[model samples]
Target: MSDATRLVAISPLHSPKSPHLPYNRFLFSSFRFVSNFSNCLKIKHTWSLKPLNQQGSIPISSVDSSSPVSIDLKPILNEPQFDRLIHQAQQLHESLVVLWMANWCRKCIYLKPKLEKLAANYHPRVKFYCIDVNNVPYQLVVRAGVTKMPTIQLWKDGNKQAEVVGGHKAYLVANEVREMIDHEDQP
Candidate 1:
């Protein structure tokens, strides 16, 4: 499936009325497993249950529990309760790197786990975060001028340092980020 299609499949599009129930019902009822021409599975599966906040939406929580190696990409990205991501972004350190992505972006999903692993490896050094451009504030998006699906930015002392505009290879990006961190650690 195309990235856009995959993104749509995984992302729960906003519904004005009965947001949770409708989607839940659709999943338990209308949602069907269809084999594509290439025999690929067309349905998206979300087994983990997320916390529901007072706004009738779910809050994204990090998968930092028992499964340290496993990536909870959804919780890391989506947080309807918070207005700005700077708080979570700041959790890493005074310096941080934010990944601005869209749910329907295939490259984002493919690269998420790798990025998570990199964060796990470099924790407390390079703060890593993922923000869904579709759901985040428009002002920040405009400030960042993010026109692509998977844009990455490095911040130092809460200021913008550098950024990668599009989705690149995970290893390459990780190396670059590591280099940036190492450079900052220098005298």
Candidate 2:
């Protein structure tokens, strides 16, 4: 469905008041606050679940894969942390999907959530991270050969294996990311 025709609901508690919450959602909201913020006013009451015995968060593995769960892609800043993350992922033998983007990039804001949904599909096994090109050292972005606003790269064996430059529409970029992940799975 086209974006303008699509309907979405945003709750106040779904509120991202904290910096710890997903920054991408914050960016999207900030960008279109005038249009979508009205949706928030329509919310008369906050949503709550029927008294459940559970309290803490559930691990993604325990959830059924049939249902798609979209989680925020964790942010990695600075070169040391970036190198350490790659090292950690390599040690664990996990693939890394890194979205090299900046907060100012509107395209990045649109693409981040879609990538997060994609991240959920491969959760734990293939971890996802977002490194802001503007935040990290310029050398890092240059070394990664990133020359675009929203560049999604798949890292395997401590190296970049595939990249999807998110210059097109969000959905198309998402599909290409999925295909990239699927294709990289084979020998």
Q: Which candidate's TM-score is highest? A: 2
Return the clash pairs for model 2, or none.
Answer: none
Model 2 bad stretches (over 4 Å): 1-14, 17-68
Question: Model 2, range 1-187, lDDT digits (tens) per residue?
Answer: 2222323343223544355543222111111122335354232222222111122233333333333346678898888988998898889988899999999999999999778777877877788999988788999999889999799999988988999999999989989998988888676
In candidate 1, what residue range of length 10 has the lowest lDDT sum?
Answer: 21-30
Tell me the tens digit of each residue's lDDT in model 1 across 1-187. 4432422133343342453533221121134455666756676544333333323344465222332332233333344423244555556456666778888988877766566766655555555778888876777677766778677777664456777655577767666766766676454
Q: Estimate each model's TM-score.
A: 0.50, 0.68
Candidate lDDT (C-alpha), each: 0.56, 0.72
Evaluated at residue 67, the lDDT of candidate 2 is: 36
Error of 1 at 115 (Å): 0.6
Q: What TM-score does model 1 achieve against the real structure?
A: 0.50
Q: After superposition, how far is residue 163 of candidate 1 from its true place, in Å?
A: 1.2
Which 10 consecutive residues of model 2 have the lowest summed lDDT? 24-33
Q: How much is 123 displaced in model 1, in angstroms? A: 1.4
